[model samples]
Target: MGYFVNVEPGVNLYVEDINPTGSKTILFVHGWPLSHKQFEYQFDVLPHMGYRCIGLDWRGFGQSDKPIDGYTYDRLADDILAIVDALQLDDFALVGHSTGGAIAIRYMSRYNGKGVTHLVLVDSAAPTGFTKDTADHFLHLALNDRPKMMREVTDSFFFQYATEEFCDWFFHMGLQAAGWSTAAVIELLRDENVQQDLRQIVTPTIIVHGIHDRVIPFSQAEEIHQQISNSQLLPFYYSGHGPFWEERERFNSLLMDFI
Candidate 1:
């Protein structure tokens, strides 16, 4: 159940759609430096529960077309819109992790949450305070020493113990992305702020964040919960940036309960 959907003239995003005939659908947007594969744990179980799970790789990442431009949040969100239209998806729960959550926010605001029934943000990297210097430093690392940069990201990804094999797998996923595209997204992270977009959301929203998250602090998730009118905050006490994998059972249970 995997295929490519052309989001634009020259770009086609890779999508993994499981249990396509399920009554309930959930669309997953993965975080930065990773692709739809990041939801491997969720995909393994959700489909068996009679839920249709759809995950997509952002342009320039995973199996998607890599272009030099269109890394901005607006354009990224537009890509999601194209997929929705192409798949004719309706009343589906939208789940996004880290940077993906920020993109989901943009999609909700920019497209008026078209066909979205529920919104889930997991350890979202939004309401950021990133500066130009931060972006430049990360961009430099991405272009010059991507392996080192990805290793650092992998080290801080989880609070629980991950096997050496797991860490290697995660690190390689980041490396699979185009170097320029990785830098472009770092710049997007530096420039974009979705606080206003969060307020504009009328959809029922859920913010699931790790209590000990080092990348994006717990405070940001709290702030996001406060901004969204119909939102609830669920903190993953024993997790770090990746609750979906770090605490897969609990995360899946919460997601099922919410949906």
Candidate 2:
């Protein structure tokens, strides 16, 4: 079942919890314009592996409240901390994907990872920040033409040869996010590079990326691995952006081993 954790006045974040009684918990933060459902594949497998799994949908994403503002990384990090505090999660692992990775980096650096032990980043954005060309292009699309951004990105970057059924679902999930959120978050992520914060991560870290990822280039993963001391980098050679879905068997196996 899922519960809404209120992070601020009139804002409740949606979170789905599974196997809550398990000894160790894994909190999953999703990428841009998606929700906890992004990790549906993981939830289907992790609970049976004797690990509790929690998935959070930030403000204006998924089933959570979609206000007109508060889409910055700082607020997103606060939302995550609120869930941990509300649920009293302790000694748990944090798994963040894409933009969620940025949020996780901010959360850990600002709070020094109070209750977190292990960290996993999947196809994350680069801490060094997006190139000016890329940032300008994305910012324009986000602010001026969101539907085009959603359709093009969803088709070209999100899925590479996925079945029609899966592709449709992924596209729809992107649509579910509020337009204000989709636009605001793009600018927020572009402007807020967490390079300084990534240096502050003392917890053990592992970075995963799909070699052929177009949305966030694989070079971003290399930069993160280089910045974070002693962090492991795992590249999915045969996969693209969504490795968890593209190479489920290998990803699940690697994740189980990593944990």
Candidate 3:
């Protein structure tokens, strides 16, 4: 099933609610410059594992409404809350990747994770914001020719084993993202401090990180695992920034175990 859930006036978040027969649900939040389509692997495999998978496109990405406002973390959290309430979801696991992980932190902290039973962070950006230099470097890259920028960023950082066809598709997916949200959220990720939010995660959590991650680094995942009272770190030894693509089978197996 698909939904254009109304978040606020003139803003409807696009959500794909797949396989409704299962009793357990997993809500997936995608990373920056990408949409829930990023989790096509999970969506394809998880349903066979008896999971009802729900994927959302944030307001400014994918098929969701691209409003000029409401790009902040707090707004992102509210957008999630709107979906949770709309679906009346309970005892569901919330999975987030990259920037979405930080957004999950904000939601769990601010809302106390009311309907959530478990939390999963995949190569998340949390506990520590990006350093000024690193942030500035990414900002510079994003400001240049957008398509070329996406190609460069994907090649240089996101994947180590991705084929040319995969890279091309990934670049196109990113190019569909709103320019304003892309630029603004980079600064948001760089400047917003989420250590306190990380400390407040009461839900049983698992932090997954690729050992070879150059974009967010593996240490960031360690920091998240260390701070969350009920959290464990799961390392993707042979993967880079995107283990879901680089190591799909292992990633799926670990995720099934968590479920």
Candidate whose TM-score is highest: 1
- Give residue 182's lDDT in candidate 1 (0 to 100): 93
Model 3: which ten-residue window has the lowest total lDDT? 152-161
- Across residues 45-158, which tens digit of lDDT does each residue of candidate 1 receive? 999999999999999999888999999889999999999999999999999999999999999999999999999999998777356886777788898999998998899889
Error of 2 at 151 (Å): 1.6
Residue 89's lDDT within candidate 1 is 98
CA lDDT, every model vs. true structure = 0.92, 0.84, 0.86
Q: After superposition, how far is residue 1 of candidate 2 from its true place, in Å?
A: 0.4
Best by lDDT: 1
Better of 1 and 2 by lDDT: 1
Better model by lDDT, 1 or 3? 1
Q: Alpha carbon lDDT of residue 9, candidate 2?
A: 91
User: What's the candidate order when arranged by decreasing lDDT?
Assistant: 1, 3, 2
User: On a 0 to 1 TM-score scale, where does candidate 3 land against the true structure?
Assistant: 0.96
Q: At residue 129, give the lDDT of candidate 3.
A: 55
Please report the TM-score between candidate 1 and the true structure.
0.98
Q: Which stretches of candidate 1 lie over 4 Å from their true place?
A: 129-133
lDDT of 3 by residue, 81-145 (tens): 99999989999999999889989889999999979999999988876657888778767877776
Which pairs clash in the backbone of model 3? none
Clash totals for all candidate models: 0, 0, 0
TM-score of every prediction relative to native: 0.98, 0.94, 0.96
